[model samples]
Target: MNRAVRIGVQIQPQHADYKQIRQAVADAEETGVDIIFNWDHFFPLSGDADGKHFECWTMLGAWAEATSRVEIGALVSCNSYRNPDLLADMARTVDHISGGRLILGIGGGWFQRDYDEYGYEFGTPGTRLADLAQALPRIRARWEKLNPQPLRDIPILIGGGGEKKTLRLVAEHANIWHSFSDAATLARKSAILADHCADVGTDPAHIERSTGVRALQGSSPDDVVGDVLDAGATMFTIGVSGPSYDLGPVREWVAWRDEYNARQG
Candidate 1:
């Protein structure tokens, strides 16, 4: 599918109170972001390590009821945190609440602190990836068996750059592939992803390429964003957090989204 360039914002649910976080979501939607994301981690990923932090899926459920336009989800929920079937039901429920605008961005568990504090096993990367590989199919099967079903086919987003396994999962299952990859890396891995798609009998062009704005490298005329676009990224996201959730970057990227889409037209 030929998708228009889109802008997303990850409203990091850390170092801020819920009321403040709620307002940030409102601000992002009003600024015209295409998607809103929050990550799945038990505690703060930056700043004060013990700062105020909220849970992921619960916040996403609230976002479904709160926002009227922007698509909402986790930047990447840890697959080990919840059972695949339960997670699928939770996603279906949120999809209904959002009127079918949920993107189920998930990945193998990371950040050992979340695992240790939460009393879950902080398994090795290999174990975590294996578990994630097992979870994806079960998630889909459960999605099919749910009452009322998802309002739409929930788009799956796999976030990771592991060549041997993560990219293979993306090729086989994902509708979107997000990574913190630079243009050269994206170009190379996208090719690898294509090879995986070929092996899995999936279409290489069907997966929409995504990246974080800060992950992009280069200081060109377009700050190398154009290079990432050329390499296949259509969805670009920047993260905002805390005391005052700034929307200036969000607004700037929204404008960039519009310009890129218009140019495409």
Candidate 2:
């Protein structure tokens, strides 16, 4: 059977207080979102560049206990930020805490600001992608040796649309592929992914298609939902930022989610 569509909201990790962030997670789960995500960044990605921000994995660890039912993960954790082996253990711990509700969303490091301030090498994109390529295997190997493996296999979500190297790595390693491209770009890239999968003798269908749908002005909740799913995006993730964490948009999307699921039935 074809996999059913689901909605996700990336409570943007910028300009929000913990109280509001926590509330957003609770509300999203209550509203029946399938997943909740936060980005990995040192500073705000939106709003004021120097505005309030929070760390990714720590927030996810908290989200694990604060909400039940909805899966939680980083939109894509930067590989350069932590030791890959350590990252595996961290993910395993969160996976157990969340009762196997963690999706290990990760990617080649971007965001030079994060690297510059944190003392990580702000290498060229090529160098960073190389590091990511090397880390994937190390992370997997450590997971095997770690005392208690992840509560489940803990799905690996790789986000990037790079054709030559990144998607090749996705074909080999990721359980989910997330990219920011529009529908046409997604269709094109997915075909490239299929070819990569074929080259590796792997079944492409095993990797889920995940895409980001940045909320647009004046767009109604129903319109966003309809357009994204119709675009062949099964997993839709909307981003929200704040001092308010105004889940006004999330609430609307959640209502639409209920309707979408009912229609599927």
Candidate 3:
């Protein structure tokens, strides 16, 4: 299927007060983003090391209530933080609260600080990926047995670029696959993902390709967005930080999405 181009914004839930974050979310929805995402991290990924930060799922619950239009989720939730069944239940609850707008974007844990401060074992990358491999099935099964069940199917978005394991998992399970790849890298990895999908008897087109694009310093969206589209990504995401939470670039990308979707149509 030829999916329509979509725009998403990751409102970094750090370095600002909740009020500021809430305003950003409102602004993003009002400005016409299709999806709103926040990262699942205990600390700031940028700026000061000891900056103000908030927990992921709780804020998602709030976003579920705060906005009525855009789909909300973590850019990628860490599989190591909570048990798979519990996480599935949490996602189901959020999906209900949002009236069916939750996207369960998850990944194998990566940040060491999160694990260290939270008392989770800082396991090796191989072990972490293995754990994620084990968790996906349990999460799906839990979703099936939940009392009320998710409001919808709860789109599963897996974020990572590991060609061997992560991409394979995405091929096997994800409704959406997200990565931070340039056009060339996206093309290569996408081909690899297609091969993985073929091996697993999945139609590669069944998974939406999503990637993060930086709002270039003083450049038009046309400069980079077209290249990414050519690389086969239908979902484009931009990361906007808090405090100011500039939406100028977001607006531009939204316009670009409209134009692109029109052309596709």
Top lDDT prediction, candidate number: 3
Selected candidate, larger TM-score, 1 vs 2: 1
**lDDT of model 3 at position 138:** 95
| Best-performing candidate as measured by TM-score | 3
Candidate 1, residue 2: lDDT: 80
Candidate 1 has what TM-score?
0.96
**RMSD of model 3, in Å?**
0.9
Instruction: Give me the displacement of residue 200 in model 3, in angstroms.
Output: 1.4
- lDDT tens digits, residue span 1-265, model 3: 8889899999999999999999999999999999999999999999997899999999999999999999999999999999999999999999999999999999998999999999999898889999999999999999999999998888999999999999999988999999989889999999999999999999999999999999997887788776778888889899998778999999999988888778777
Report the lDDT tens digits of candidate 2 across residue range 1-265.
3567778998887887889888888877887889999999999976689998899999999999998799999999999999999999999999999999999999988898988899999888789899999999999999999988887888999999999999999999998999887767877888899999999987888888888875667797666545445545678788877766666666676677677677888
TM-score of candidate 2 relative to the true fold: 0.94
lDDT of 1 at 95: 97
lDDT of each: 0.91, 0.85, 0.93
Please state the error at residue 25 of candidate 1 in Å. Answer: 0.4
Sort the predicted structures by TM-score, highest score first. Answer: 3, 1, 2
Q: Please give the clash total of every predicted structure, in order.
A: 0, 1, 0
Lowest lDDT sum, 10 consecutive residues, model 2, at: 223-232
True-structure RMSD, every candidate: 1.9, 1.7, 0.9
TM-score on alpha carbons, each prediction: 0.96, 0.94, 0.98
* Candidate 1 segments whose C-alpha is farther than 4 A from its true place: 215-221
